[model samples]
Target: MQAFDLVSKNISQIIPIPIYVGVFVVLLFQVFPRIFIARQRSIGQSTANRPGKDSDTPNGIYDRKPSLSSLVTPDPTFSWRDNPQQIPREIKPGKYFLTMNVRKLDFNDYIIFDKRYLSEYRERQAIISNVGSARIFVAEANDAALDLCEETLMVTVDFLVTRYPSMFHRTERGVLCVDAGEEYDLVTRPWVRHPLETMCLLSGDDCILMRCCNDGVLRVAAVGLVYSLDIDWTSFVGKDLASIHRDARIPFYESAIQKSVDRYFLKLQPDKPVARANWLTQIGPELRNEKFPDEYFRHVSTIPGNTITPETVVDDLYFRVERQAMRKLPSMRGVVFKFHLYATNIWDLELEEGVPRRFAEHIRGLPESVLRQKHCLEYVDCILKVMDLMAERQEKNTTNFHN
Candidate 1:
């Protein structure tokens, strides 16, 4: 035994302790990480493709998939003619008040997944895939916007899973199941993937999630918008409400409007969701890339006396209405502003009995400054001509009735 110990001691002396320790340390660093990474990848693959009990079976605890046929039909109908009765009493045509105009949003109106869902979802997914994290913004947990995103995502998911069970399934494993048997990890942290991304995955609405700052100004911290109209959300990030509306043609930041908006945000309760509508006229129906430089519109004016008629207006212009909703998240105490866009041909306004007249009256009542600010000066004549045609048609109908 002494001889064996003397041989081992001689070998140890030949190879220094520090060299042995360095070799072990190098192997530890190299081998463990590879093993850990391999294990993680394997686990991820299994989780993604793991087969569970069929979601189609009738189960008391699990919800069945929602019927697509029934879900596509929009409720309360989106008619400009019917808008007056639907609008709050305080909101009138000439004077626009955000808070007073808003009404309690029905659960069905909260997140609309219409027939355009598939197309819109595809476009949104493409944008997110192409842009990566550019569309997602995050602030520190201590920041006012911290919990806004996650909470909004949670509520949206819960609402869909509960109400439209056929469309969304909650797995026994606590995973969210959507179409094509796909599963999502809804509980992932913002650093891994913002909750807004998950929301985009679930619906077509363009979400602009905001939170009140220390300075008492609402700042847009996160956005998941694929069809933003004339606005780049990136520029608005971290900006206060007033700053965001500084260049807006509409008088959204007027003293009264600003105060009401502030108060609305402050007093908004989790139980109540408020919705308001904004309408605009655009030259095309393209959903994405609605944003163009102001100079581009200005340059359109330089073209010498471009002739436009009622027929041209009907053929060329589109009417866009954005249904916007503001809901306060109970857990985060932050606001989630969602926008659902709809567009129709300008001539389609005539289909509704009173909508054309109301629209014409509203357009004629706008001040010159506001018209120029909205860049409507160039096409105002065309819109007026179309309005005249509608008026003439209404007058003819009245005359025939009297005869």
Candidate 2:
């Protein structure tokens, strides 16, 4: 016992015990976790790399190519010119002929049949759509309620499918049938037998009547005397028209976003031209070496109207910025960025809590009936952004051209 006590006293005198404990504790906490994780990961990787199990094969996946039956169906062979008018030759008394002598109608014209076609045999009402200048026709049905004034409108897409199968087809470009029941949600209700799909009708900025008929046939003939406008030979530059449309009003926001892209070419000037200066004139040495910034954008702003204005209102602004640096001038299209800015300071800021009343009100006041049907904040925001981008691009283009 005396020898053990003497040994302990000698060891304490040789080293600091607390320092050793602290070093050991630091190693345990700082070094061990990383080492343990590395070891586990290495072991797992080695096991995974060992080999693929014998059961790893796809045995019987079916191919999805179109079959012969789908492609080789016989369809009617009707030519537009050779085929005489399909309207009934004799208009018996009380059976109205839904025909009018329209003076002029073009490819993008829309004709609605508000007048009703009557047949003593069948009691039915239809709305006919004569799209563009083509021979195509879309008949939409309407049934009078107990009160004739309280009538319901229906699209005759399915009727066209059954009665006029020759009119619809899946072409290389797109499907032509007004398959509204499947194409759109508006036709799903049993009460609505006919639902008009938007693509099935085409209209322009011209005065046209909306008419209806009873024999499941609707017609929109131009009023007065019909005029045919023939294209003069060598007038059309076919491919350039595509570019023109792309630059002008191709749908969605991309066209608008590209308007300000010329600014990037201006930015290529190393001297960094002043805001008001012609950016195009000052292509700098950096551009010669093809050195451009990783990120570049120009800012433009506009205020919302009095109705949408609030202390913390939706920014609802859009800019059409050019995107030329990434591609050719013709290819560099526009993009629209839409976002709302919140007002950190306002009176009824607390009132911003619930399903925002102002937002609902905004949705309630949409001008488009189609948009109003699918009323949601995301759609509203997306469309607003698109408009903003378009407006910004127009404004910028005007400014640049005028300057």
Candidate 3:
């Protein structure tokens, strides 16, 4: 028994605790973090490189950037007719069919009013009658302006459709609309977008223009113009939201149409507020999936490339009122322009500000023809300046209010 006990102690002494300790240390410090890092790299590569992998659906719409091969349409050489010397009579807001060029259409007058002006002169019955309400600006000479916008939108749509036919190849079309809400819902709600802003189109083969205006009459003659092609959402995405995604579910070239649709409008509404700015996910066909593709999005250790970050997400919204609001005219009851720009602080979200500046630089770089129009230029500049001011105020740690 004594001899057996001595042999067992000898065996224990041969396999020292230090040997086990060394093996565990190697596994913990050297091998484990590398494995973790490899896993992280694998996840990142899978999520970032796989373009639509984050997309829950095997086939769903996504944005595609324009290629260099996209041909640029030559601008018509400037002619004396481009800018008329004598200011045309201030055309009242009503439907007109007077053809100044190759394009013509039934125009709808969208009225804008100033809320601040209405508030101060709320009780002044006499003052409201003379100036018509207070601060009001009407785009009476929008014929030339709207024409420019339409022409640009048409060209843009054609360029996008032809360049990436795979994405926008479907026979179905979509419509453009302005909505107060931000998101694309596949199950219940439809994708809503603004079709016309700085651009316009009357019809095919017709020259389209959109003019900008402020004060009692239109500002500048053929200035601040954006040139792009217009697209009908109905023709591209079907009649409503349901039809569009239902067709997209087929998961082929037809679904690619949704991709084209997303890219087309992404270019159109280049400076649009991000959905996350209001803590809202962009409602699209992607959300309809039962489970979100968690693999597509990340915690964002670094800056995100395409997707918006959660910290930068804006739960509060800021609707901007431009200096143009200074010219609002009171209506018989209220003001012409009904909506007002409402804003909230982005600082509350714990994000590094200066976002609007970065956005402005990108927007300003678009085609010169698009940015050179008088009225359109003024409005664009006004919006950009306002955006810059917002960032500036944020940096200075000051409060900004828009009335």
Cα lDDT, all candidates: 0.62, 0.26, 0.29
RMSD of each: 19.8, 29.0, 27.4
Candidate 1 C-alpha error for residue 253, in Å: 3.0
> Model 1 shows how many backbone clashes?
3
Q: Write the per-residue lDDT of candidate 1 for residues 159-265, one digit (tens) a residue.
A: 76655566677775334545435666754433456667767667667787777667766777777776764344567677666676675645545654776767777
Question: Which regions in candidate 1 have their CA more than 4 angstroms from the true location?
Answer: 1-100, 130-146, 172-182, 188-193, 229-232, 291-314, 394-403
Query: Higher lDDT: candidate 1 or 3?
Result: 1
Please state the error at residue 83 of candidate 2 in Å: 55
Q: What C-alpha lDDT, on a 0 to 100 scale, does residue 403 get in candidate 3?
A: 19
* TM-score computed on alpha carbons, candidate 3: 0.19
Every model's TM-score:
0.67, 0.18, 0.19
Mark the regions of model 2 whose C-alpha exceeds 4 Å error after superposition.
Answer: 1-9, 55-362, 365-403
The model with the greatest lDDT is 1
Local error of candidate 1 at 215, Å? 4.7
Q: Which candidate should be chosen as best, given TM-score against the real structure?
A: 1
The residue-by-residue lDDT of candidate 2 on 1-403, one tens digit each, is 9999999898889979997899899899989988999998887667545553442211111121222123233335422234421211111222212221112212111111111211100111111222132212122222311111111111122222223345444434223533222232332335232222222231100111112224322122111000111222122211122243354343332434333333332222211111110011001122111111111101111433433221113232221111111101110111111111111111222222321233234334544432322222223554344334544555566689999
